[model samples]
Target: MLQGEEASFFVLCDGKTALPLGTAQDHKRVGEGDTGPNTGGMGAYSPAPVLSEAVQERAMERIVRPTLREMSRRGMPFQGVLYAGLMIENGEPRLIEYNVRFGDPEAQVLMMRLGGQVLDLIQAAAEGRLDEVSVAWADDHALTVVLAARGYPGRVETGVPIRGTEGLPRSSVQMLFHAGTALQDGTLVAAGGRVLNATARGTTLQEARDRAYALVDAIDAPGLFCRRDIGWRALGPVQDAPATSQPT
Candidate 1:
């Protein structure tokens, strides 16, 4: 949806099957899966694991790089971040949609993976020196689970009491980012569609998945539901990966 060079966007479509797929999954609804109406994204995760480094490189060379070249040739001079949402069906990668800003859950996952270099990356992007900025990824995996309120998107029941979350392991592997929270009488309550993002990183995807599910259990909220198989499909059958708890 480029409008007179006002915004930047890119789409990656599968040459075989024309299905919309993106590297990130946005929690459009307050509920799990793709149910309910859209909201401001409850949470997101990235590096998707599905879009491997090789795939991204191919997309950059074939789709993104060429698109940027075309824009420059047209005098549009595209700049800023361009999100290329992709879908893969029948073992083929395809385009989904485009966005000017970072995808929510995808941003969170990427941030977790990037760790302390986020500010540096942003600065490089601003200065148009993105080519000079190389992304160094940790040999680990991350998973983010969104905590939402009951009847969210339609009718959010705010001011609901939120408990359990103290003593969460604050390591390079585990973090809890607040999404929709507020302080009322010195008590934290659910204030929006998604309230919290319980994220965990580990040496492997299954390890990260286990830690995330453990955090979900510690959180005593009954209104939240997350996909337990978030990274399972990407991780494939890892003999060393730990087992995750029951799905939330």
Candidate 2:
């Protein structure tokens, strides 16, 4: 098995031009430090340190451009978000998959950074005018920790009342997003394996992570769980060794 960090890059394409929108790394495993069984995604952070501007540019020139070229050659020019899932080892990127939509928790972190830039990008791409518009991303980092039901990626106990959603921070820097939730009898309850997303942005990845964790800790959902190290890979070092993660 090839062991390395995983990342995904997002781009808005109009068959003639591809507009990049940065990248993100996600925690795939259900436990800390990439331990336990693999899950869809436990948490995520944006501006993955591994996918630097140089690497992103290389990916665009090498991967994204070629793929779009091939699609056009086949008379199927892509005209929307083109997502690339990659495994990076020794600073070289290897393709894991290609998605036409946003990556899971990876999208959460990027959207936190992108904000309303999404609408503009989508409109431009849909109209085949991507070159006419540009994405103005903030020089900031974002982290999102998924709050899952106690037994996620397995048998999950649902209908558990979730508290602490009231009076929480909901600003550009910090917020909570509900996923698999339902309101019964005027009470919010967990309705699926993954429940909420505690997300935040900051000047640095560490600061965003701290703010996200604070939001996680404020929740009173006894049936929920979250991974503590969302940005471990980007932050450098695990304990004795370097951190490796995925988009996972």
**True-structure RMSD, every candidate:** 8.0, 3.9
Q: Please estimate how well model 1 matches the true structure, expressed as its whole-model Cα lDDT.
A: 0.59
- Please provide, for model 1 over 67-118, each residue's C-alpha lDDT reduced to its tens digit, 9 standing for 90 to 100: 6676777877665556776664433444555566666666666667778876
Q: Candidate 2 lDDT, tens digit per residue, 131-180?
A: 88887878899999998987787889899999988979999999898889
After TM-score superposition, the amount by which residue 163's alpha carbon in candidate 1 deviates from its true location, in angstroms, is 1.5
Instruction: Count clashing pairs, candidate 2.
Output: 0
Candidate 2 local lDDT, residue 214: 88
Model 2, position 26, has a per-residue lDDT of 80
Worst 10 residues of 1 by lDDT: 12-21
Model 1 TM-score, 2 decimals: 0.75
